[model samples]
Target: MTVPAYLHIVQYCAFGIAIIANSLLLHLIRMRAGLSFGRYRVLMISFSIYAIVYANIEIFTLPVMYMQGAGMIFYVDSVLKNHQDIGLLIAVSYCGCLAFCISMLATHFIFRYIAVCRQHHIHIFNGYKVYLLLIPPFFLFLIWAGAMFVCYRPNEVKRDFYRKVIADLYEEDIDQVAFIAPLYYTHQTDGSVLYRISDLLGCLLSCGILGACFTTCSICAYKTYNKLHDSAIQMSKRTRTLSKQLFWTLGLQTLLPFITQYIPVGLVFLLPLFEIQVGKTMAVPVYLHIVQYCAFVIAIISNCLLLHLIRMRAGASFGRYRILMISFSIYAIVYANIEIFTLPVMYIQGSGMIFYVDSFLKYHQDAGLLIAIVYCGCLALCISMLSTHFIFRYIAVCRLAWKMEVYSTEFLT
Candidate 1:
């Protein structure tokens, strides 16, 4: 299957997981009601809202991905090419979703930090305060999303993107490509002489909001951690454990959006602002490298979290599963590290860094050769380890499933 197809399947799986997990969480929260921490319930509600928004965003994005992969660019391009207002609405909503995600994560961090650090001040976040906190991001995004419309005419920027895609496909000079069709659609010009000012505005808006939220959360987390370490502090053992869980969960939540979305979008904006000439071919590898790097880090974080959860729930007597899990974790880490490390290095080397090879390689020929050989060895080891790990895992899981199936069949008979 194609990469986009694989990604599409993964997205659907994620959506399924989100639906089930979030539904269970919400149901449990309702069942427990006053039993658990009030802040947790509120956070879960926020998470649910964010998940719905994210799913919607994915719904819009999947079609574009499918269209691209299916060689139906003309289908999307025609609408984007012909209808200025439709393109503007789509662009604005997409940007809004991106900002909304960050905003929600920021709120998650803030809520968790406040709940742990400032118990006395927790009442401030209750009742109407939650609504007060959550609603502003919607309005803020609406304003920020409108910048595209204000900064440029509807369909103008989108037309540029479509034209760029067509030019690359036709092997035409992308630099000289312009909209040659007659002025059939109405165009609203913002008349801003600033170069790609909409992007700068977007960067400032997204970064400003997220930065503020991050800073606030950091301060709260520090104070809370310090309090936890203090013997004088009167927090219950359960509270402390819950606090740690909250922090870990928030950390994962924060990292996913920041790594996957925030940084990539920031780069997208900055590249135009800085005039980084990334050609069509070069862009894919760079984009994939960024994605893989983020996934690598996230996988490590998740493995650690999973280990912690296992220890917490299963104690030290997990038996064979402990060894199995540990081996899987180790292999995953090794493979991800190798993949992430090699991809960018390979990209750099393959891209033909003449200056580096000429100047540095000339002076350090022996060292460079040694480094390359060591890297090759490590890459080979990673491949071998991953192959073994996958084979063992598949056999173990399949055997377990077979046993379960046999037992079920016997019971039915």
Candidate 2:
């Protein structure tokens, strides 16, 4: 089969599997653990909504099957006539999905901040704090919806519908000629510019929110993990397990989106400079879909593992959760090294042999030395940062201990 057909099958299958897995895991959590379905409820709901929107886009937009030897062929007959309603539904759902993701991220960071900064504060344990965490995203979504309503004539544009359909249909079979035709047609000035402006604003706002959440969460995670490592705090097994669960879930949650979506999008934006143009644009949609699907799957598995860890550490059934977490951590580290390090090194070597060998020959001695120096410097910097982070965490934990000692002395006096 053609690439498009393969992608279609893969995308749909992954979506189906992820949804089923998440649903079953979530059901098990609720039944076994009397856990309040608070923030996780939002996450699961968002996943379900995204699955429906994504599947609809996949089915409606992509070609059904390919014709043998005729290249990628689309079934034009099954196309929906009134995709306007679908577009609206998708847009609303997508906004909600984004809002929920941001809310969950924000809540995670806020909780971390409270845990680290006000660990002794009794009010911090109050359930009301959870409701308070939802306020920001709720208001942000409302503001966005209001602005979109005021600014855009939703009826005038079919771009979202068209793009969704075209993306699903042609993503795998992406011939430059075929791709550019739809892109040109879609960009034609047919609607009030308000819709475009609204979209731009929404994108900017979402980016800002995500950036803020990521920054705050990174600080919190680094600090918390550092303290834990340095102080060697004899936490209850439950606390240690919970902390690990939070660390891995929130860490992956923050990092994966950047590694997958943001970085790939940035690379696409920089493609103009490379001038090596063998279907570079086609890579974007494919990467976007792959990243999104992978991130969601990882998130679901992480959350499920987290639930299991919480239960197991809190005196439930077996110690299987600890084994699962350890297995996952090992797998993730190995996968990261392979994907991020080994594959990239291989690609660089292969590409250098093919393209850079002749260029290197001309500036052989100087270029080789400079490249080695730069590589070594980067490696040194990474090690230094890691060391500094650990040292700082140790110092902070020591300070906390001193404060606690002083308080104890005063109480005794």
Candidate 3:
């Protein structure tokens, strides 16, 4: 499927913003005095690095996907094209980073669990404890990566492998080796089977670890809260507020990976196997793609707000042009909202309709009328603003104050 141009445009814009914002954030974290210490700092720095690498890969690959007209197709052949080895590595990178993300979250939850339930023992575990815990995932990632590389059989005939992969797309893009081989089967030629087995193993391991951490954290948090509530020991207001904030932050971060990675991956892999129909509107991977763009959107909004705040604080006088600048700002806001709402709605609802002025008007008449009015109003406002600016400039530059005063007096009479 050729991706809609609007989607491509949005993705590019979002990607750009995300890259800048993530880089800035990483720099700030590294440079900030208070944030540069402790277990939290280490984990955050790791996350920032992960995010930067992921964004870099996306920046490189997204344009290729967009230009090739691959749309939302994620098949290895379509995305990687002639560079099959690199493609396989990219796939491995995706899974490895996913595992890394899960491990990070698990570690975070464990820390929280200990801090809440066994604060005295936290020092015993220390920084070395985190290092030990993180090492296993790296080893696991290596094992998973090596297994995936072998599964594709890069040393073998490329054409044969491509055909096999394509043939198996019907059965979730598995090779015959996967369908025919037993779960425990192990052979040099059993690339596909090993791939499936390894994927399942990695996923199971991540889920098990994450689940354990989450359960522990939940129990600890509840117990700690209750214990504090019942105890006569007084906690400082600042301490209580910080604890509450940390609790919510961790809770939100814990939920993030599940929605963005786990659930979407689950649906994509499982839905086909079960032959469940989720309707045309359901695109599980699309959700993941959209989620990837979220960082960019957030960055864009944040930067805009920050700049506005800076201007306000600096007391930058707008003078006679304040109204003019304000008008343009409002116009920009309205225009952005209109396109954001209208394009997505039309594309999703129009049922294969291309996003164009004619198609939209033809398909959604009332909406078209409203849109037309908005366009004309915006154009009129823009022209009026320009005319007002030119008139003022002429009055100021050409010494037309007397003419303005005479006109004002005639209007008053």
Candidate 4:
């Protein structure tokens, strides 16, 4: 089925906002003072590229589906007709996703290796040499590219061979291949066992790498915290504050993706095995899509908070938490009202409002006005929250610098 126009608009707006925010974040990190640029810079760049590619692919592919619906053509045929473009889009997106995942995983492992196996040699890698960091991600890209090329066979192959190839790759039942293959071709199932197999492998690899990284990072972080706690000399308040911010950022980053991707996928897959109705199967995937998009939006917004944490850690004056609280409150109020009112209005008025406006108002204006007011109000509030959070953090960092200088002079005297 084609995506609704409203959803297309929403997706476009979301992509636009995320790209702008992520770009600004990259700039801030580069310009920000006293931040550990070497350690976090690659991570941020990888994530930003991943987000951009993901959003673009969604935006491009949805319209293709929409065109198929409008023309009453087969969706799979349309996708194949546009295969070169679509393939490029998916290739770029998956590459970025792989880079982000592998880099993060590698970073954690390297840190763990240094901490546990070669503590004395840690300083040798302190500057985070770009050449060393790029090696793992580059290898990951090459592997993904090879798999994708193999999976995306030309449309003339026999169905049985295709299914066998896919099943062999993913290790799934031949029957299950039929379900996913329709996505790529019209007469024969696109359920190239190959694509599913590759995807399954990719997911497993990503999970394994991420698991190792998290374990190592957690251990290192805990050890560092304990060591700091045992130190009796009056600890620098700046150091303590910075540690807190870093901990919060890392914790949120580690947890959000699993909640967004794995949990939803697990729930969807489990529902079917439990004998849920076939009709409900679509609901699970649909809901999963929504949840995934929401997660992406939240992750992008959360980066704004990350910037604030970096500023605070750098001993820059981050403005009072009260401002952030107030900004959040304003956003909550606007969002809650929009959510509470929109459904009721849509239900109570129904299509009657459309007819009413067309007949009486002669312009069908009120319907548009209502939607505009609700959306605009919510958007305004979100912008306010984002702006205030970043500004307050900037102020806080400045304050930290002033305090640091004062303490330094007093100690010297």
Candidate 5:
């Protein structure tokens, strides 16, 4: 099967898991959920509904993501490939779905706080008021989706920036591709890259949304955790056990995202602002070295080919790009060699992890520091080269000459 077809299988499997897993959860909630869980049970079901909807969108859109600096480009490779407008909407809506998940989880935390700590205010979640609480998540979903739709709209400039990379990577014509990117900077008519205020603001808005929801969830989670253990609550053994179970359940849900979504996304967005790039790693246990090594081999071989091609075929047609590509290919090969030779090892102790790669050189380990520096230097070069190449494409296509004055006021602001 084709790559996307395989991805579709994964999406379909997730859909099945969503349905079955959520079905089981709902069944448990229906049968065993106590009076204290009445408000939470309803919200939990809605959460499952959101999950199913998210999976459904993935099945339809099947987006492939590529991150560049503080920006991300999404290429939709599903049935909607020909329908760029619809595909764009579907792709942007993925953000909404994730935001919905965040908001719903936050709502649950808010409700849990009410149920556990402030029973007198529990009436706020009863009757019609309960459904009213859905407004925040719904609003957040709209805000997230709306911001992306407005900021990341497809344009010649975007296609110009990513055209060759997309064409080279996906082997598809940029004209026919349906892609969206909320770029932090766009190459201006002149040669310099300018900060895309809208896109940056959109990203900041997303962070704000995330922060608000997380803060709400954290405060509520903390309060609920405390109240569940409080001695003055005067609860029966059964009631206390059920309340504790619910509190723990909600806490686990909150933590899963902090690991999966919040922290990683924060880093992904942050690293770009400072122009740092760490090519790729399993970031898991040592057993995953097989995957890392396989990637290293692939990187080495592909970069060798890329370097050779640039040398042989990157004539006048490649122009200035010829130089950048050659540098990148060399950097990739060196990076792979560094990984392979060092065979870096990492271990976890308590709550922290440390990783160090000793150079294969004998006795004199002074070279290890140089190896580490080279690795970081390669990443920085890779990131900057990518940005330069994209701007080159933009300037070449747009043919806009940037005056030196443009640099002082608006470039990379």
Candidate 6:
């Protein structure tokens, strides 16, 4: 897939931001974290490092995922595109990170629960034993990646099925594209569908991992919350307050990924398991952007050159059309600056579509929205300008009656 120039801009921007942000987080965890953190501070720093790794791999790979029916086509649009073997690892690592994210969060909650409710087991996270806390997430990470690599083998039937969509959506031949697709439903000679056992089992494995992690987090959170509330358990005022604050903060943090990652991953599995056919509209709008930007660049250059030529001609040859072209050239430059910088990523789900902008305008909510609107409004004007430009050309070239006489109009004529 041809990556959007703006996507590279976005990913690199995000990469820089994630690096700085996570670096700061690591520093904060070490310096600012109080004595109460103890062994837990080690876990926190490890997770922050994990997050940095997560962001680095994701940004580097820049995988564009499109879900179709029960299957999904995952491919990279990055520097790694030519290196399928490496890209494959990066892609699998990206998937593993998803699992690790869940498992790590679960560990955090479980650790908290143990610290508050069962101090005896807290030894698992102390000193060198602290590294043991990382085992579950890392284990799940490998398992998830292994399952993805083993189960989602590229085959002829799957290739044939995906051929048209690949061509239409990505402008890439199915044969040429290296993508991982796991189609759950297999069609037979009689047109009856048989369950792809590999796909089903993969989903089971994924679901089991997800369920266990979520369940652990839930049970620990519940027990820890109740334990903290229990007046019977003796603790100092500062200790109690700090524990409660950290517990609630972890709970809130867990909620973010649970909502963002877990729920969507569940849907990816559950929707197909129930055989709900949600039609996929794979309109990336990247094609439009490509053509528009390419034309806009030419427009800027050619129009500027034309204006220079008209300047040498002293505006007598092209007249008001020269002024119009110059105005359009200026407009094109302004439009390019605004739209390319605040380029929107659009997503389609079911019958709805979403436009997301995570550019510099992200902090300014209303301004971001207004800028998006302006960008879109400019696009509409560009469309209108195309027709208007052609109409004026038709009048000048084909219609003699309405044609402007060269050097005939002295003033407003």
Q: Tell me, by lDDT, which candidate is best.
A: 6
Winner on TM-score (3 vs 4): 3
True-vs-predicted CA distance for residue 121, candidate 4, Å:
3.8
Instruction: State the number of backbone clashes in model 3.
Output: 0
lDDT of 4 at 355: 14
Candidate closer to the true structure by lDDT (higher is better), 2 or 5: 5
Count of residue pairs whose backbone atoms collide, per candidate? 0, 5, 0, 13, 1, 0
Candidate 6: which stretches are off by over 4 Å?
1-10, 274-413
Candidate 1 lDDT (Cα, 0 to 1): 0.56
Candidate 6's displacement at residue 305, Å, is: 58
lDDT ranking, high to low: 6, 5, 1, 3, 4, 2
Regions of model 5 farther than 4 Å from truth: 1-9, 34-36, 187-193, 277-413
Candidate 2 TM-score versus the reference: 0.48
TM-score of each: 0.66, 0.48, 0.53, 0.51, 0.65, 0.66
Off by over 4 Å in 3: 1-15, 30-37, 60-73, 76-80, 125-130, 136-140, 143-234, 276-413
Q: What is the C-alpha lDDT of each candidate?
A: 0.56, 0.45, 0.50, 0.46, 0.72, 0.75
Model 3, residue 249: distance off in Å is 2.3
Worst 10 residues of 2 by lDDT: 176-185
Clash pairs (backbone) in predicted model 6: none
Write model 2 residue lDDT over 193-247, tens digit each, in one string.
2224443454455456556656766777777777556555666666556656656
Tell me how far the alpha carbon of residue 236 in candidate 4 is from the true structure, in angstroms, after superposition. Answer: 4.7
Residues 5-57 of candidate 5: C-alpha lDDT, one tens digit per residue? 44467667877887788778878877887675676677887887777678788
Q: What local lDDT does model 4 show for residue 403?
A: 40
Candidate 4 residue-wise lDDT at 277: 21
lDDT of 3: 0.50
lDDT of 6 by residue, 11-129 (tens): 78878987998899999987899888878887789888987998889886886655566676677666776566777788878888989999999989978888898887777776798
A best-first ranking of the candidates according to their TM-score comes to 6, 1, 5, 3, 4, 2
In order, what is each prediction's RMSD in angstroms? 10.2, 15.0, 10.9, 11.7, 23.7, 19.3
Model 1: weakest 10-residue lDDT segment is 65-74
Compute the lDDT of residue 98 as modeled in candidate 2.
46
